[model samples]
Target: MRKIVYLLFLGIWAVIGPLHAQTVKSDSVFLKLQQAFMAKSVGLLEPVLSNDFSVGVYNSPIAKYMLQNIVSHFAVDSMKLKAVERVSGKNSVLFIVYPHGEPAITTRAWLNDSHKLLYVDLFDQLCGLNRYKVSTLQATIPIEVKDGSIYLIATINDSQKPLRFLFDTGADGMAMRKSLADSLGLRVAREQNTSVVGGNMQIQVSTGNTIHFDKFAVNNQSVAIFEHVREGTAGIIGINLAYQYIVKVDFDKMIMQLYSMGNYNEEDKGGTTLSIKNGKGILELPLNLKVGQKEVTGNFIFDTGAGYYVIGFGDFVKRNELLSSGFKPYFSSTTVSMGVSSPTFTGNFEKMTVGAIDLRNVPGTLKKYREGDERATIEDGSFGVKTISRFNFTINLAEKTIHLTPNQRFNTPIDFMLGDKMFSFNERGQLAVLVDITAEQLFKQGDVVLSINDIESETLKKDPARILKLQAMPSGSKLSFKVLRDGQVVTISA
Candidate 1:
């Protein structure tokens, strides 16, 4: 069986392209606005946007509310428009935003017949368009989740801190790590069989006193604490404590905004929201999904922590015949580091279609272990950067909706995707390769990348141009690298 894998990433642009008459010329208009914002030109945006224009940053009425709530006093280091494209016959312009230390982004704006801005919407790489507001506040909160009812994770304090907890929307109460529980002198929530939509699991839970989130503090909060939680995960602030207000996740600015839920009165909101149905839940998107000839539907966890797409092995074996098709398919297998126990087997699958977009050769892994007669079932899974990089996603938790837009910069370089290749940072901050290898080469994982042809690693870091020429190298051909293994530098020809 032939194996196929669909991979994607954020893309970047070098220069603005020339525009035809009715279309706005892409020169520095976007960049100038970015710089103005960075320079705190709060008074200027009003004129540029004009009174006749209404900018909706997240495709909802709340977009304005978000910005107004935060921007009353906010500061930004920088905001750069990497690329711009005209949509809907020049009436709307889609802007892709790239900010330092933030995830990839794309946003949409609509202009009235008079060329005045009508509305704007923002999209994060993982979650789709969310109600967002640009604020002068220099602080930002970033969140991520591996698995759960809610796809997002929250960080209240400093993001770089060694001790931190993720916010879970599905958990009935709060949870905490054993280490933090020990330090806080709090007892673990009593262990019980808690039933979640995904499945039933055992966890410790307890109530807490006060929960602090930056300047926004909740006093005498009924917070649940879980002990013996996974390592590196200090605890969780779940939905039982969440829904207090209108929440905004601004990926472009790398900020998470929390509003008093009372402020959200307008019914119109972002993306489709999820609701309980027959003891399960459903998050409906506007698009349809199909696999092979069958239409696939179910509740799926929008997990960002899963580096790769995963599915239950039993379903894979039952539904897919790739293994017996006579082709040797290569699968990415790694240790399951989430909880405890031994390593398990995981296989990859091919071909997954979401509406008209067909992801060819997309890889999947078996998520559960198998014993004779004992079968395991997995909750549905959704694509992440492993495949979602092809498009921009906007997740509106308030509305429980997700929006997908074609990502212009869908294929760009990021550190996470650089695999098995030895690299050093060049002066331009780009990862520069110090060695070259081909399909036929035996490039072991730990093989020290010494030098490229004659250029040494040190020299390559100083000059990235050395490896750029290797792009012309043919597959299956020998590429030489001087490597130091054991000790001495030796030529390890690939």
Candidate 2:
């Protein structure tokens, strides 16, 4: 009996020792992940971040730009990891984070056998939805529409022959390119006059119906088509389809899910709830401010499409007496393009306060306009992605709630011009790269630039056989240019 008891004790001790060691290792792994996230180490984070995450907040420029700003400015003031829940029989863990200066955010981290995080999902607590399962209409590749209310994208056409569309939720209705519509043999019924607020833009809407997608077919019942849209997009699915379902955009797996009415799950809601008012969506946040030593009430828009921070000139001027009292521009090297519809200013503020929070040396752009009127349309200075990206935020349309959570994982501000460049093609199929840099010695916008060493876009397109001969040029590579600036022909070297 004593020998049996001894054997049992030995067996229990052996199991418990290994279990305790595993627990320690798991804790260590979690800590390492937290450290990497806080450091904003992209290389170290690459091993842990899930590439298969999607954020389809009705494709509003606000949500897109806000999240983009967060990733770009990858730094946070404070991050508190409050708790972690590990599910049985799964390699995933749920984390609840509290940000000091911002709102709270919930995220999921999945580990591989090597104990490295293979996936991470940033959740919008208001919607309780992830990238993959935000909707019920499931397809590997889907299309999208950008109405102001919903960021709607869908998998159109047959499953065997699939077509994907991305709709801008900021837009009014479904739209597509003329060339694409012609290729599809779509017939236009009538043209209606339509106008957009920003940039003094206007378009002619054409209503038509055809077989949109094979699986998610849109005859006359499912869609209304418009042509010659804004924002240089191909086409849209629009509010017709979006209003009927809860939409989700899964960027990770490159898929879209649409949930029918009364079919949403209660797992984890994301985004802030919103309300539609007088043909516009209103997301009002309470704020306290002083106007001439008198407290005044003010409301701002949650505009994601506007990329930077903008403030009302009238309000600012009245409070600080800036217009009549001239001040020097903060930065000496500031320039702007002709068609970009941002405000103009010659002064900068050392600090600006939002509620009780004070932002130092906040780079604010001032615009000339009334409180809420732009080109005869209702206009309000919006809180753009620049300020919103400092924390994780969501708007719940269902609950009519707005939630703001500070994100601690980000602690680094990204240099935009140093990271990536934009590219497009002219009408002649010649690729035009809108180099996102202002190297006065090298290149400038509207320069009708010729070539960068051997990287002549026109030459490359004409000669397909010489594809392999092309290579990436160094950052500061020397190049010759034939520029057409202000109708004069000049030659320069850099």
Candidate 3:
């Protein structure tokens, strides 16, 4: 009995030993690190840091430059050492940092396996770094509209079959549908915390050796894989373009042009130029709005991935205070990659502006996330494609500038129910259902919707451009559907 009790005690201690060592001297060690960073004295931190420290995100030279740049600008106000081994790896400590005037930061410090300081992980800084390369001086690509969204057709590797990809400005990394990736036997590079349209998740990141365009190609690019992708799209070409070229989108003409950094000239681009702040591919600009009795301005992500017009965070929306009059619940959406969504509240603001492009009575939502939720986006809010598609825009990658020219559709009211559901064309060449992102209950996950507003699914499949435009059309604030559920035909108005 005595021997067994002693062995049990040893087992318990074995488990707790590493846990305790991970946090021991964490406060004093991080304090010294912060002090040394401000002093710019490599010698001061030599005792705590490993002799061979490596930077993870970029090449050595650029990573060192980025590191020093951050050290130089770090606020000397306060430093708090926190344990987050799960995020930063074993024996990690981080500061709950608030950059003096900039956005809140999530940074982690690294320790070697021997419990010596290895390096620091500045997630925000690393994510914002753009070393993207483009080989083309100028190129033009045709675009097709489907379900009220713009899509680009391209090839994977040397394959003859063309796959459709969304030209999304808001996505940080390029992403593909898991089903497509599985069918192609693509490699998943890693799985980590990542952001989606209006939420965040631990997503599977994949890599494609080559993504070939007509005259250009991106080599060794990484893409995230989502469980749920809208039917017809194989993946999305995200903000990766921002690192390499200037992109001009003309929806009316159904054309897209890419210009190399040196070849593109923003001076000739005439429109309302908005100076956007960016880190990684995420873009945020000053958004001015008028609530009931007060006017406010805040930085919001200019996100094209989001389907809604606007979605704000808790504090940001509270300050704007558009909910005093009790705004109604709009559409709530979530991808299968991520389950249920955060509660969303909706209302209209008197006026909203991104630079000089103005819109009146714009519908917006507040996505509610608990404080300090890792799923919470770093930005106070996001601006979606619904409002942005109304403009002809030019995004200059090298300069971090966006020019917007209002189109006639700019005056069109934001839709209350911009319904987007999961679907795929069946082997029999008919549109089949997968899931619905909206809150309304219309059909089960596998039910096949034969038609919308009397338009035949077979005809729309043959000509998807027409279906895209009609999908966005409002049917008296509800949809009339002809669905085949369990091999039985049912007509329902939802």
Candidate topping TM-score:
3
Residue range 66-158, candidate 3, lDDT tens digits: 555556666544556655464525667767666577776656776666666655656323544222343354777888754335688887766
- Against the hidden reference, what TM-scores do the models get? 0.45, 0.40, 0.57
Instruction: Provide the clashing-pair count of each candidate structure.
Output: 31, 63, 3
Count of backbone collisions in candidate 2? 63
Q: Report the backbone clash tally of model 1.
A: 31
The lowest-lDDT stretch of 10 consecutive residues in candidate 1 is 5-14
lDDT ranking from best candidate downward: 3, 2, 1
Who is ahead in TM-score, 1 or 3?
Answer: 3
User: After superposing candidate 2, which stretches have Cα over 4 Å from the reference?
Assistant: 1-167, 199-202, 208-232, 235-242, 248-257, 263-266, 269-304, 309-365, 368-375, 382-396, 401-494
Candidate 2 yields a Cα-based lDDT of 0.42
Residues 1-494, candidate 2: write the lDDT tens digits: 99999999999999989756555545554565566556654444444333222233332323333334444454444444433434555455566555546676666665544445543455232333354444344333342312111123333332232334444333334666566665655556655444333333333344445434434555453233443433443455443444334544432222345554333453335433333221242343433233222333344444433334434434433444443444443322221111224344423444445544454434444454334334323334445444554434333333223344433312222111111333333323334344443455344555554443445646644553332232244566554546556678566665
Span of ten consecutive residues with least summed lDDT in model 3 = 54-63
lDDT of each: 0.41, 0.42, 0.64
Model 1 deviation from the true structure expressed as Cα RMSD, one decimal place: 19.2
Lowest summed lDDT over 10 consecutive residues: which window, candidate 2? Answer: 409-418
